[model samples]
Target chain A: MPLSAAAPRRPQAGNRAYLFITPFLVCFVLLFLLPLAYAGYLSLFKDQLVGGTVFVGLDNYLRAVQDARLLDGVLRVALFFLIQVPIMLLVALAVALAVDSGLLRLANMFRLGVFIPYAVPSVVAALMWGYLYGPDFGPLTQLGERLGFAAPRLLGDSWMLASLGNIVTWEFAGYNMIILFSALRTVPVERYEAAAVDGAGPWRIAWHIKIPALRPALLLCLIFSVIGSFQLFAEPNLIQRLAPTVIDSSYTPNLYAYSLAFTSQQVNYAAAVSFLLGFVILVVSYAVLLLTTRRPRR
Target chain B: MTTTIERPRSRRRTAAGSHVARRPRSERRSNLLTLGMGALLVYFLFPLFWLVIAATKNTGDLFSTFGLWLGEDFSLFSNIQATFTHNHGEYARWMANTLVYAVVSAVGAASLATFAGYGFARYTFRGRGPLLGLILGTIMVPTTALAIPTYLLFSKVDLVNTPWAIILPSLVSPFGLFLMWVYARDAVSDSVLEAARIDGAGELTIFFKVTLRSLVPGFVTVLLFTLVATWNNYFLPLIMLNDPSYYPITVGLSSWSAQAVGGNGSNAELLASVVTGSLLSIIPLIAAFLLLQRYWQSGLSAGAVKE
Candidate 1:
């Protein structure tokens, strides 16, 4: 329905509407806005022995620009995003299309089975995968030995990112698929009938009709996936126990800020790092929004 | 226009019906799709399957036996007993903590979202557009980036290390509010509100008596989403709470896994408990997801398709 048709006629409760919104606005300001403003406030100062807490005026952010560890962590997650998100989204798209195709039997079972992982906490998922990735006694290694060849070191320095990516993909692909699948369900049946009458097969119809219609939903998934990529933490943080040599304190930007504040007690610099990370996310998310939405114009 | 509320179900039926009508000519293609789905299913389910199997084995069997098959001994019951009874029943405490945090946050967040969403949808007020824009804008901010500052702010107020730290931040869910805004715009009609007002009902009464009934599905959807999010939350609690007693199952299990791997050799026994605890922690959530599958799926469609 067009939104204008649904616009409220005259302000029935006008200012009284504040009564309903007050509760949310209260929490929003206290929990979200206050901390955000405080973080900005906290970022400008430095705790130095001589001054005991002097306003440094963006010194932390200046240091962040030149900080090798922070830069490396950002690059690492950017690479992770480039490689993992496409593979994950493609898998989710394929599965969602397959389920929507009506060719699969017990589609709901497949849907639920895939979505079950999403319900499992990331902490649990990480631990389960960690146990399976155990070098000496993990199931994969034992299976490899039984098959008479040494298995590749999944938790080794060389493959840790890929291993982390796999776990993330395993956890979230089903969720993206569900989003796409529901979007598919909302397509009017008349569209399919029109395509069928035109002699298009299912594959052709899917490629031409369904996929094009899925652009907005796909864009939604892409933006969320981008945000998730930047905020990568729990999997690496948990798996750090098993592979300490490979994953360091600054493994991801979020992890970097975490250790800086909690372990190193550098709350000032950590606040700066977090603000920069949040800024990066906003810029990238906006860029994605522009790029995806711009394409349809041509 | 009343059909707007019922549209999702009817649309789903037509979508499913169309597929059945086209089934006869695609028998060969159907087999291929089925095979593809079967492989995807295994990829999705294998880790969960491994978790369940590993939870059934003793610590020795976890390493010594074939990872896929049953161990020499059936230690499932013993494993459950040990998981719950370990470390002075810490696992149970964590579970209780998680349940309280999740339930309270879900109810509060959903209720708040409903009222705000309805107010935005059905009533005209000052700052509506800008306020909604700000709320939507926050959704782009990565939550982990906010964790440190939130912790610091909470600490200043002496709310850190308490359940309030976790529950307070969780109660403001931008995505939930956005979902409700879209849902309420369609689900609740202006005419209904107008009639209730003409009959001399107060705004709050109309909401509670009239609007709230129609918004139940959206409320449940937001509730389930927040429940999962709060239950699965790790980073916030890990940083905010220093006391072990306040740990949720996520932080608790991670601590145990750390002990199993990084601790001296004797602490390796916690490995079995970790696996069993991981399995136990997920059962209730998985059950909730499966049972509420329909509501959430519709919720996603309402949010996604409308946008």
Candidate 2:
């Protein structure tokens, strides 16, 4: 009897645990769980001319499947992920390795310098970069002209995505580098010493040892980058105000959802789009984690 | 040492060869890496420096002069004054709104996340793992994706454009919750709680008096993150708030920048104010970082250096 009683837990303590967690669960359900459920509900319906929602059952999902703008947004973000993730992660890794070497003077200063931009608001960073990329009074344009080169229009249709990519990379590279550098510090020094004694160069040692040890952090950074990449909004949205002719209402999925709800007054469709985006993010994020985590096949 | 020098000629040969052989290539590479790092550093820092200089200049100098160079006039005080004064003191109201929103939301989020994290870490419950995975998924699902849905829900409740709409969403930071959970798991032991419980401390008392003290660093990290995130939140407020009077500095300054850009030559003061406003916006962040740097620095190296 005593063993069984102890095995189930002290009901009093279990009750207390329930009591403590109730607040969180309440907030979680009300804010997150409920909204998610509401989104799912909305996803199943369509707008009716009778001023009410009609149950359309999965028609919205089917429409989303064939939606060209959503597809274009996905493809655009795919391009963004391909080009930006490698560049950002490489730079972050290089900086982390350099900082971890313990040989760089003013390391803290450099680290802070790199990380400061991340602390700046994304909108402000976008604005600052937007201004920098502007043709008139833009230092980049003036400098490029002085150097006898054409100042490529950055906010136009051709390069707007790339410009946004630059802003994001600038904003987050330091953050990712900090993550990687911290991971790098955890690496045992003896491994490097052993490699050094074997006449292995820094490149060989880094590739063989540091990179392997940083796998988890690198994975985390990649996961975060994927999440952030797909949620691209503020840069394009803010820039759209200044250059709306180039950046259409559907420049990105989030923007599309925003315009749908607020501008076009298609709340149901926007909710559907939001769910579709959430689903896509979930799928891509899961795939990324699975792909990154799977052991390389022999 | 002397005995080694006498007996180990091979080791000495290896050491000397190691130095001579490894020196040139490593030195050259290090130099090249250093140069590259320097260039990257400049590329990152130059714009911020430009913003600082631009902030000091009046509107006439903003366009007529080089952005990278310093202007002759010093109108930063006037620019800040103008930022506050020009729009019926709406910028000041916006700053106040930002402070209120950021402080309340950040502190609230940190508190909730910490409490939730402690609960998650200390208790055994049904569906815990799945619940945790759900939270982690929430972290990956960009807050932007939820903006419209959240707005729709808020609008249904007639809460759009209000502080609650922004504050409510800001309070649920899955990443912050995760951090707190991880921190509490290791930092707060069951025995400590047991001792506290045995000493007649209630759960609230134990959490506030004991657990929170140990979790100060995590709290600071979360607070800083929430502060930066909430303060810089543009899209949420952009969609939520229709009134310019309720705009946070980011949106306010963005609108100012756009309007100034559109106004052509006459809106130089507004442009100058925007520049000044941009510089001002960074001060709190820099100050917070410097003041809370020990926490920030320690937060990075905490789980990082542990093998």
Candidate 3:
């Protein structure tokens, strides 16, 4: 019985098996583990003129707690997460649901069209959108002028962040759709057949059947978006040059870390900021995961 | 009971105009759905279409002409020439740099992820559970969160500004590992490995002779993931690199755009080049996405749903 139980598993090579994992373990130690430890270690010190880098022991965290620049960036991304994630996920969900319904012709083409933007590097997307948002030569501005109205200043201080949101939404709407659509595909055909025999309309079938089955996928996407939304960096940073007055160095937390580290040469302080951002993300995403995940009935 | 259940469904199917009867059937024409889908298609595609058109215009015609329409002049080849030749051939260098970084990192990451994934899937080792958990936990730590500390660490060895700054970090793919772990578990059967072992194949040869063949799909998946991540990377390079020569296409193009604005209309000519360069940078990725789309889509869904 003992041999039979262990039989289903492949031969256990004992210590020799570690060789298979050595390469990734080395990288995992270097890139993932050591950097985190170094970040934590660096966050506890402050570089001073005469004294050199000295241990301040949570003073950096205290300073980060009080820093308005960091707070403003945090709140900005928080607002972004709240507003943009839903809009983006809704559009993605809509597309996924629509395509899964088999109602849309050339569905593969449309799915590909929606997904192609995701292939465009975010830097490229931001640049394209930045050009399109240009007051001088962008199409929308020209259309506005041709229609005898003042053109919208999309990259202006008022609309720049939301404009950044649009770029993000455009980039990933297809990605989330594909994920959700795949989950939708896993739904049993018998369930749909049963619903149809009950004379349920398409809307009813979708609402009660497809969506409930899609709950886990929805939760996964929500968590991914929540995490992604907080880490907004590349689009805003790239768009800043096009709208300098609107996007300061402290526009996003990651951008703030870059500015602090490279421009201000405050590597120690930037390490603190990075950890703080990570901590908040950890707590927030954990809370979302806990609240959203449901226990299966026995 | 069957008749009782069947009568209502038949009645409803007949009454509901055949759309609900069979979702895939094209018997019914729904204008509202067709229109909604068309709008979505435009929303996704209009920017690329604009980019193609924008690439064809010179600085003067780009601004003066209706932005959506073709201009009086076709300067696409000239713009292409300008893009390649701009700033003493820096754009071409950036392209080369990005390609090297992306390809090398992709190969390393895929190989590492597959090896680790296969190990985790097929082995029974000490601390396997905790080690796998630890690897998965790293996914929550965003790359931006790690950038500063990674920089601090990399600078200790003075790797900043060289390709290693980007490529070293890009090689470790937590999500890729996770994907391959699931793939290896499902795809590589235990019986096959046991058979290889009984045939006197060494562990290393078993991996090369048996395991790698089955892991190719997963390896390709991880390769594409890492390739795209490296190719599109911006912040890591923006922080790590100071030299224009080391800049990838993303950072390089951004600096050009910045220069265009900072010069404030004297170098308005640079804007056209920036547009054209952006077009050039994305073409390869778009082509990759279109060609390898089946693998990409299947790979993405497998990773997502398995998670």
Candidate 4:
């Protein structure tokens, strides 16, 4: 049904198409490809004190493989991905379904209220959450005191990760809900009618029809969540000030790479670490695509 | 059969008119659902509510009073004043810089994505599949992974600490291109272009006059996305720019917060400024989102659900 397939092909049209795409291609090369290549090239060498910069091929990567700090950050984010992504997606799915069901009062208000956080910048979200997690002056802590109970120090070493996860979830759940809700809107009303004819109620229709139609949108959200989790930086980096003891420079891989290059002057090593992290992200996303797509659909 | 159907339909009409009394069970369920949504709304809006309350308090009351309640003094105007005048009006400069970057990058990226997407959708060129695939594949690459390397590359060309360093990278959005590609395919019909061709309009002319009009929704979607990305960008600008003048609101507010947290006693006053500045920075974006909600939502569904 595309125009390209329907219209007769012209000889010059193919060549002329390049004219339109060239600007984007030039930028893509300069910004995306060139930086990736340079990062790869930078990853191969090590900056040494005695000999200045030396080409130590694969050594930086090998060291990264054994580097406990880097690997710990990777594992931490993997754990974060496992815990935070599901809760956020589930919440998003619940909110989207509620809005779509038309059973709740003031659905539009709820949708917009939830989505307001997405418009807030991550830096500001982190800052706001940091203040709220303040042990001494935070409203939640003050409320706990009024209620005659000791609130857990949210920014403490044990609770820091969960607090960061809450910030991320708060920022992203509404966004993911919008995506899912939009997809839900595209589902035909006839399906609901047909399901009702078959003696299905709202709960049964949602479980059977609505959810099955949401798989592609859910997968898209999952892949994005995976990428976002692996690239976690701003929240942890900003919150580090409040929980300095809990969050070191190597708290997340991206933060680790940042501190490595900027603070430690290990630019070459930082590139290697980031490249490896990128590889892990690629593999994880690929695996997600594989696992989700490989399932047999009815 | 007609009487049987009429009997049920007449009864259903009355039931619909008096549904609350007719279906008490469903009514209770709906009430429960509304209550749940209210709880979720509180969870979502509590922080923003806290922010609004926090901005009104002075530095002393900020530490002394409850975060959710108003302090004895309402310093919202003075806090806003302090935020703007801090460090010789650096916050205003950052706001201006962010506007330029976001507006320029949004316009550039949207224009480029529209052109490329139109080209991809309308033409069958050599290596089209691979080229499009390459663009899509770039989306998965973590943006943070590229920041250090992009910084390295930009520094070599003496572009670091400049607006170009931020603007150049922000202009190339693979996701925007993909969204437009999907949008253009469905939005612009072949017959329209054919009609324009017969009228002796050039390809570029047809694109500007015809294709662009239909693609406005998609273009606005990409523009808003790129606008938000550039406006909120932190990692790239943080690594690229060292000068305070070039900082976007995100980076500027971040530095102020950092100073508030870790600086000496003199900088303790910056905490109030940070909260107020954040409140100011987000207002325009949230307003834009609310105003353009119709376009972006439709554009998103068009690009995503159609695919």
Worst 10 residues of 1 chain A by lDDT: A1-10
DockQ of predicted candidate 2: 0.39
True contacts kept of 1: 0.76
lDDT of 2 by residue, B22-98 (tens): 56766566576777777778877887988888888898888877778888888878888887797688778878888
Q: What TM-score, computed on C-alpha atoms, does each candidate reach?
A: 0.96, 0.90, 0.92, 0.94
**Per-model DockQ against the true two-chain complex:** 0.66, 0.39, 0.49, 0.54
lDDT of 4 by residue, B1-307 (tens): 1122234334533433353444466667778999998999999999999999999989899999989999999999999999999999999999999999999999999999999998988877888878888898888888888888899899888999999998999899888998898888878888888899899998999998988887888899999999988888889999999999999999999999888888466488889999999999999999999999878877777655654
Please write out the lDDT profile of model 1 over residues B49-146, one tens digit for every residue: 89889988999999899998899999999999999999899999999999999999999999999899887777787778888888988988888998
Candidate with best TM-score: 1
The TM-score that candidate 4 achieves is 0.94
Which candidate do you rate higher for DockQ, 2 or 3?
Answer: 3
Clashing pairs in 2: none
Q: Model 4, range A190-283, lDDT digits (tens) per residue?
A: 6775676676655777899989999888988998999999999999989988888899999999999999999999999999998999999999
* Candidate 3 CAPRI classification by DockQ: medium
Candidate rank order under DockQ: 1, 4, 3, 2
Model 4 residue A227 CA deviation (Å) reads 0.8
The deviation in Å at residue B207 for candidate 2 is 2.7
lDDT of 3 by residue, B1-307 (tens): 1122234434533444455445544435345666798898899999999999999999898888987889999999999999999879999999999999999999999999998988877887778778888888777888889888898999988999899999999999988898888777766778888899899999889999887876776677788878988999888998899999999999998888887767445477898999899999998888887888656555555555556
Name the candidate, 1 or 4, with the larger TM-score value. Answer: 1
Higher TM-score: candidate 3 or 4? Answer: 4
